[model samples]
Target: MAPLKQRLSMKIAFITPCNAIAGGLFVVYRHAHYLQSIGHDVRIIFADGSQGRQVTWYPNFSVPVSLLVEEAAAPTEYDAVIATWWETYYDMFHLNARTYLYFCQSDERRFYEKGLDSPALLVERTYCDPRVRVITEAKWIQRMFQNDFGVEAGYAPNGVDLSRFHPEVAPLAPRGPRVRVLVEGPGGVPFKRVDLAFRVTARVPDIEVWFVSGDGVCESHWQAARVFKKVKFEDMTPSYASCDIIVKLSTVEGVFGPPLEMFACGGTAVVSNVSGYDEYIVDGQNALVVAMDDEEGAVDALSRLVSDAGLRQRLSAAALQTARAWDWDQQTPIFAKVLAGFCERPIPMPRTARLDYLLLNRLRRLESAVSQLDPVHMALVRSRSREISASE
Candidate 1:
């Protein structure tokens, strides 16, 4: 690979599952935007066909986007086609590209029950594909790929957009006598463990619990004092600044961003010892780190932050320092260099992988058609399929 200063502009395509307001997808879009700014011909391919639809959540997200159909039929070829999610991996083989890449944001297999779902197995299989070069957002994920799958994955840590989430941003709500504790993450996602954050915070007295969800849905049982649903990305700083502390408990993560964003907004955090928190979170130093699924421990940590004003102030100050070190301008160039290196060595997709994708695509389309015809029968079939998968 040549030096960064000597690298020329190369055409790149990032295949995304959808244009949803997801943290992972936002990272992908940010990468595309960064590459475009540096003179690379970059475009985002929406596998779900949500092309030309504006992502209203992200401010000034002006990266070019196209549907998978358009890319598959286009005359110009991409220097590298990267898969941003597991489902989009299958679509990579269909596009015209010199080299293929898989940007594993998380251990996606952990999203499902082990040995009880075919999707988990399929996700695992993508890691084993020899054609696609793997890159990840977390160091632990890079290590997991090497130790478990014997694949050398590149690592590029996610960064906080300091310009948007900074201490200078005014709080959305006025500070009062009661402490405001923020709980972030989608409500319904099981791995996110948002319910646990709400449950633990509820045990602490005299602290207002605020919930912010990228997905618009918040369950009635969560009982949050205030809910900010689907907030614009650039507009999230005020929400974070309004709260004193944020409690984010997740079972799986890829260098999660909300806590760091909270840190950038001059707020402390209470997070679980999930895989990626170790990247920056220091227990009792910058943020309170509790064990996963330990409800009592989380409650204790939240209470400590709420009652001990000195501790909150000390931790928030330290957190701001940590956030300062993780700027987007510093981290995004690492990924661009990875892409430049990948384009230097092109690998042809194997015939077997191409055939496998064709067969799997046909089966999935048939399954989708059947589910549309009889929803009840398909539900029963999925239940039985889970049973068989478990047995296998």
Candidate 2:
């Protein structure tokens, strides 16, 4: 592709974690993609090389990914090498890049335990590091890093692929007089609160509820709803299209993506009244926000949205407007300007880093091999095995 603008083109690399269908890594990938599209030299290298999982191109994304194959892969000479995760902060730290940046997708401290290997302090150190320019996806995260840690940070929110996930492509189907309700990440992973969804579902027996998750997040609660496992990224249009009300319960997040995807595909989002969603989800306007612990309120909100067609259509229209604002076409130039400020650095990669890269590459291969099993089916197998063991 020819360079769009006649200026400020530079080499850039994103030190991303795992080649999974994850949100944070995708944001980094999409950023790299946008920079490349605008005629900049861009590459996405896996952090530790160990997480260079098997699949480079998943249906969820369309970016060409690469690994730190050689010690020379990450030469300090690159214009900028942005780190996508906390662990990779150390990777970017050791690299001899001219300009170093950290992509903060969320407040990672939420993932750590008090005394575990993932200590909050370790994650906090990356945020507080003076050498790295911190750019966060959420304003709350930017404020947290600056206010609590006394660090400088900038905010850059995520955008949806409007062309790919729009209402026309995934048309809403006739629900045959029954309100089709959709709940994401069922009952496991404490934050998703699928269990609470089950409670709400029980209250609204008249409506039809469907659950979706790649992992066994809804294993125990599978019987509570019509569950679909490992729904491929491309295949989710129908899921979003058919549902009248989508209730996504998250204890914490960084502007959750699925709700936006649903919104883009003509579905109304009934989300938790938490930091991640409150920024964009204006209650009664675009989305219905339920209090974190208010299961009854969640039920009532779902009932109100499903039963009222005008309310659902109006909210979805406003939601589409919100989604349109965050489209990559609009945000790409803004992101380019932010990185342009730091690409002046030029350095050389150390030969010693090769050893670490090779080891991680080997481990990543092993992880890739093991992770090939369908996560949900594997969870089922493990559950059955345990039951057999107990019976024996």
Candidate 3:
């Protein structure tokens, strides 16, 4: 690779859903910041037309911003336009760019039921589209795309922001006898499985459970001693430092960051062996890893961490060592290189066939809806509605 100073600067645009406080959006902003730091012209284009909106949740995220509303006049040309989410892929059609890329953060198709949700097919189409270049944050996602979808993708692991999440922040609060356990992710999202985390943590005796939700929702059934909602990105370090262990039982992820963040805050984690945990988590080494949906195993692991002080000390020590190695400065350059390489290649022609798939999916949904209705009752209702309209 050439030196940063010697390389030609490329104009890059990242298409995002909104300037929301999400883990995925944070990653996008981090890459944009790094690329801009290296003398490249970078901007984030919000598809929802949130013009002049800055990401206030994340500290010091000062990348350039633009609006990319559909049917409006297209923005100026760029060397590369990267879609950060599935819905943003359609927005790429209206943009002027030399190269289009999809930043696959996760197998988003798994977020919804296949048959019931119509958008699953649309999300799947973005991965299979041949024209769009693909880059992912997890090796597992790269392999899954290769084996499952036959689309090879570049890989870059997400890095922790060490300045905010580190061991030297502050001392733990004065909880003399009770062990404080933290559970992250929104409770309303099914894939996060916050309910399972609550259930397993409740089995342990005399432990204080804290729930931190991005969506500010806490289910009534959850026995949370304290709930922190929509915490700013910079303000989360104290929460992690105060807890001894974080229980993350997410069913799907593309290199999840909370476990890594917790590790940086001088704490251990009990995580499910989800898709991305193997990237950093070592079972019984740095953090305890249980099988997915293994309620009993998760309960036992949390209980062991609460009761065994020596074990907790060993895991937290090893976890801190792991976190120190994955700084943002080190990881963002790999993603920057991937983007630069794509910009150097020949621009492939846009695939118009995706529009055909979109139309067909909409028709299929309409057909399914019509098939569920009674034809004779529908005819009468339509005739009566027409008569009412004619009278008016």
Candidate 4:
């Protein structure tokens, strides 16, 4: 007899801006894919319609998908309706559903757009809207929403597709005599600090740096390196596999996906000492950590990694250990539980959750202030960061 898969009691639909090559969008697909695989009737509705389902990860995705051809295409009701981005909320709020969820991946309030109160603030307010239950991906993001915005959101980290990024790709893969470095660019996103990453690439000698983005930042700058447009999701592992190092120096990130993706592909990452992944990364153990503004630190880490192949191997192996626990198989059920809780009502979070939020949130604020201070002010603040953390 065939075993039946556990299915949701009713249908669920996720509304995405488009099926584009983006980390957040990929996370959405994973959520929908997992739900569909478990016998749930999940659908991906295109909010942008014009994106027209052009390029999916492969020939086809796991679940049935539809497009919002007109205003009528919007569903009158569902088991749940998830808005993948904040802008989608304006439309989603009007739609009928048993439950509404904001699948928040970052602090959308930080994201800029023009508005009467600033477009970013308007997005921030959506979290406070009683109609939408908020689900955030990273702990740092949970802290941000809870402490700053007073929204007690659910936390569900995005899981890597480990089968596609198998360890087998790492063993004796083809390599050239020269080293390869990879950098990601969203072009104008301030905190992503793509420009800093490109600068580090330029400083390194005798290595090829590849710029990967659709932002066309390379069209205006960093003309020396090759630009590889974002490939299908299935191809991403191989792309990371071909690289010796992944360097990201984003000033603010709840959690960046590229580093974890590179780790799974048997590569080492040199990343910024940001809040979110501080839980997963130990400076010299799994991956190297560089401060956001430390130009010398960034240069030295890359230069050293290029010169030391053994260090890369050790880091890669340890990183795989870190990656194993975060795979989709582990995170999926936890995600399902969060969704299931909302099916009834907002689950009561432990009292400790609030304390953790205030502490981490304030520390992040202090950290950001120190990062932006003049060298003299920063030196004093660093002296007090530990003290503040203890006293609070």
Q: Estimate the overall C-alpha local distance difference test score of candidate 1.
A: 0.84
Worst 10 residues of 3 by lDDT: 383-392
How high is each candidate's TM-score?
0.92, 0.79, 0.88, 0.79
Candidate that scores best on TM-score: 1
* Ranking according to lDDT, highest score first: 1, 3, 4, 2
Output candidate 2 Cα RMSD: 9.7
Model 2: per-residue Cα lDDT over 1-392, one tens digit each = 23346766777778776565565655677777778877887766765456454554334444455665442454446677788877676665445566778888878787766762234645665675455677777888888888887866766678887877887774435555777888776344777677777778768757888877745466564444467765656667777777767888777677788888888877788888777686577898899998887988888888888778899889989988887777867776667766665444323334443334334334334434555667775455445433432332
Q: Pick the candidate with the highest lDDT.
A: 1
List lDDT for all candidates, in order.
0.84, 0.69, 0.82, 0.70
Cα lDDT for residue 63, candidate 4: 73
User: Per the 3 Å backbone cut-off, how many clashing residue pairs does candidate 3 have?
Assistant: 0
Off by over 4 Å in 3: 50-52, 70-72, 171-175, 351-392
Superpose all Cα atoms of candidate 4 onto the true structure and report the RMSD in Å to 1 decimal. Answer: 10.9
The residue pairs that clash in candidate 4, if any, are none
Better of 2 and 3 by lDDT: 3
TM-score of 1: 0.92
**Which ten contiguous residues of candidate 4 have the minimum total lDDT?**
348-357
